[model samples]
Target: MFPEPNSELPEDPSAPEEAYLESPHHGFQGDRGAAPVQAAIPAALTIAVSREAGSRGSTIGARVGQKLGWQVYNQELLEYIAQEGTFRQELVENLTPGAGRWVEDRLQELLREQNLSQHPSIINLARLVLTLGAQGEVILIGRGAGCILPRASTLYVRIVAPLPDRVAYMSQWLRLTEEEAAEQVRLRDQRRANFLATHFHRPPGDVYQYDLLLNSSLLGEDLCAALIVQAARAKPGALRGKGL
Candidate 1:
């Protein structure tokens, strides 16, 4: 079994656009899109998924990857790094794909997020995400990928369900009592809200920002996966600048 992985924002209805969910992928260092990083437009398509508490986001993501025959990246970034040596070998060959300094330049920009430039883990994770976004044909879940990758080349999907359904799902999945499940769900939802606020400065569960917003309870994992696959296939993701 895989371990579970880990934004707030208020919306102004009168505003034309939400600066919180901007195109620039400033990510964890600060508010989403608040900082600018220069990079080229990505030509390949990538899918970024943000899911509701107690939802089958990880399952749906893996199903989508299977259907699309693409690699699914979820949970802690370190798990993939430590467990898959083959991945490490492959990363070297794909580091610099073209004339653009997208990978290197993007890495530097990502450093400004937390101002922890010397932090190896943070640097490694940022580099991995930027590179993955560049490579395309990948599905990334959580870790603020929605805010970290370019909007043009990534298909952002949000999965949600009613509170009651989520409570039930959590209770069953985690083998907890109903009350315990409810508390767990609340804790999770609040954490996500905080994360969005900290990183993206957007309201909790900002459905409008995503390209496709799904109710996993209604669509089910397979159907949700199918829909995401359809949307991703409909358009090829592209990176526009010389830089992720």
Candidate 2:
């Protein structure tokens, strides 16, 4: 959909001091104390993403958000869900792709041991994805959001890089040994694949499910974000009623 484009480039509801989340306008204000403006924020546009581990998907998403002046929901989406629901932060954090298979398996075992078959985080995540997607103007990263949202309403993207490249990126980003980064990449990739397969009954890597596939190693994060912004702009309803 992008056809190769050129590269270019918080707050919270919980506290009174945090205005990013709740502020309808004034997103560019230095802080909460800055003078508020009456500018209207752009209406909703949905971007669903699936990414290979260490591909800098989150970084690219952040850049894309900056370009579009929208909010990027990566791990922060999980935090929002935890705050909105009754689940504790620890349990919500444990639900991430970085948690590894053994930890998730152990958590399931503990749940079964207690005879509580349903996990709260799992139950909350799907609903959260759909609700957030519906809200629009949100960049949904990970959590298999590409599979959950309506195909016509969302621009689904998949990010990938060669295994060696991914490992190197992860090692540098996390300051981990090359071997450790490789292990992390492998585990996270498998874990996310399994997550989508188990919950959505679809292979996470199937090409047909996504409208765009990006290689961050080849394009770099900046170009990747530029490409996505271009693609999102091209989508049918993305520019419906606002100045994007």
Which ranges of candidate 1 are over 4 A from the true structure?
Answer: 1-43, 77-93, 97-100, 107-121, 237-244
Task: Please give the lDDT score for candidate 2.
Answer: 0.72
- Candidate 1, 93-210: lDDT as tens digits: 6655551357567666655564323445445555567777777889998866776676778899998999999999999999999999999999988887776666555665767779
Q: lDDT of each prediction vs. the true structure?
A: 0.75, 0.72
Model 2 reaches what TM-score against the true structure?
0.64
Which candidate gets the maximum TM-score versus the true structure? 1
In candidate 2 the C-alpha lDDT for residue 132 amounts to 57
Residue-wise lDDT of candidate 2 within 1-244, one digit each (tens)? 4434553212345667534335556457545685766322122468987889998899899999999998788966654764576544344344434333333453455345542225466545654555555446889898767765666668999999999999999999889999999999999889887876666567877888888899999999999999999999888555454543
Candidate 2 ranges beyond 4 A from true positions: 1-43, 79-120, 237-244
How displaced is residue 134 in candidate 1, in Å? Answer: 1.3
